[model samples]
Target: MNFWNRALIIILSLCFLLPVFAADKPNILILGEDAAGDSVPRSSRVFKRVLDALINQMHDKGFDVYDEAVLTLLENNSSHIRRTDSEIIEVARASKRPPIDVVVIFQIYASTQNLEFNTRINTLLMGRLLNVKTGKHLGNFEIDSGKNFTGPAQCQQECILTIVGDKSRILANDLGAVLAEKLVWMNNGDVSEPSKNNKMVTEYALIFDGFNAKEYMAIEEYLVIFSGYTRHRPIEIRHTRSEIWYQSSIGTAKLDRNLNKMLAELDMQSIINFEGNTFTVKRITFRNKEIKENNEVW
Candidate 1:
């Protein structure tokens, strides 16, 4: 074979292997909780041990776990700001190297009971998953260490470690499965296929500025027929301004195009803007209507 022929073969082989090697995987951030139900401090040895075990187990299951040290540094730098769960998610979302897809917060509960001459230590782990973009709860899972350890009081930490070592695999597997399913739902299934009606939906805010009641009504009629539109709730209504929250399965780009077409058909001039999930239609002008006929005309 000529040199060019060998190069072509290598290129084709790489094309086939690239997708297999670079397939999208959800980035996960795992957090621990203290007995008080607040986030466990990173300095806690128990937290470190549990986190390390869970991270290793999750890695073995083909998950990309976020580095806890980086998260801690982010939190420290933003110490002046309130560190609510939502805020932590926001910080992680903004500062994460690639980006955090899911955040899982788990709390371990330990109890002791006297069994004959020995003390029995029982541990249970409860986890809640949250989507970073939406900051909404995905699901929850509870894993109990079935085996109890009987030993001296000083052996509590050792027993807990044993429980974590044995149950980390189960916890990781359960979380990995759920995370995969949720990510698929969030992405609305395969990109090559049309989004289904039953797929996950996101709520968005639509604000209309400088629109009279009649023009607003016309827009509503168009929305009823808009593809992927589910429903809408009016937040405020006025001739000068109106706000509404709507749910849709389609993305913003399609919605923007549909709105632009509707405006053109209605003979209304407007500027459409999007910020995150919120959409704004501003500087509306009715080209064929009398401005004086509408109340509170802009």
Candidate 2:
């Protein structure tokens, strides 16, 4: 075969394979915690066993889990590897190893089976997912196993272990399924409507007074620099004044804070007032010159 034919074959082959390659498994970092908000140390046999089971479950659900052994190595090598969820996230984000896509914090606790019935035991499992890049919480999910397949009335050491094992397996599978669904929604541009725990995207409109055409253009430029808008065109220009509308994944209050910080560097003195979802801006000075204040409703 000639070079052209070979090149054409290669291109066609890559076209067929690229999609599969692009859909790589999500890399997740899992951390185990006991009820007291302390990291379950490596010596804890039960915590390690539960975590291992959870990792296996995650793998079964098509996720690429970072090895617990490797995490232990990191913890031993660095002082940053404590048990808190924040520290785990920090260490995972800073690590130069595999790029972590999601951080999973798992907490397990045992509770009384019932107030009246003291024979059985209840195991509760909770998991929270956090995005590695933004450190934003994606969502929280929970699972509980209550006296599944009762063996012993009062759970002693061995009985407790057996109950915890049963609960951990169920917890791991449930967490993986929930995380998978969340990932699917996120991949399909449904991040704004993710699980109830996350802050939903909000849209706001603002009316600017005394902002001339040049300043309006500058404001539009600054919104582009803000890089928080889901839509590319976030501002609307008008003859007398301009109206700006944008959507942010953060809450309205935080977005307002960021907008104020961005607006401070411009060569304009403006007062911003927020009423409900609408913002009104009045310009006191433009280009270092005081402007005649006007109470105009546009």
Clash counts for the predictions, in order: 0, 0
Q: Residue-wise lDDT of candidate 2 within 1-298, one digit each (tens)?
A: 5558756864663465321212433357887654263333434555666677767766555455777556446543333333566566776676433456677787776644432334466667778888776777888888777445344555566766666666666666777677656665655522322212454545567677777654666676766666455432223444447665554556667767766775787756678898866677777764324323222211
Q: Which candidate is the best by TM-score?
A: 2
Clashing pairs in 1: none
Model 2 quality (TM-score): 0.47
Query: All candidates' TM-scores?
Result: 0.43, 0.47
lDDT for residue 55 in candidate 2, whole number 0-100: 76
Residue pairs in steric clash, candidate 2? none
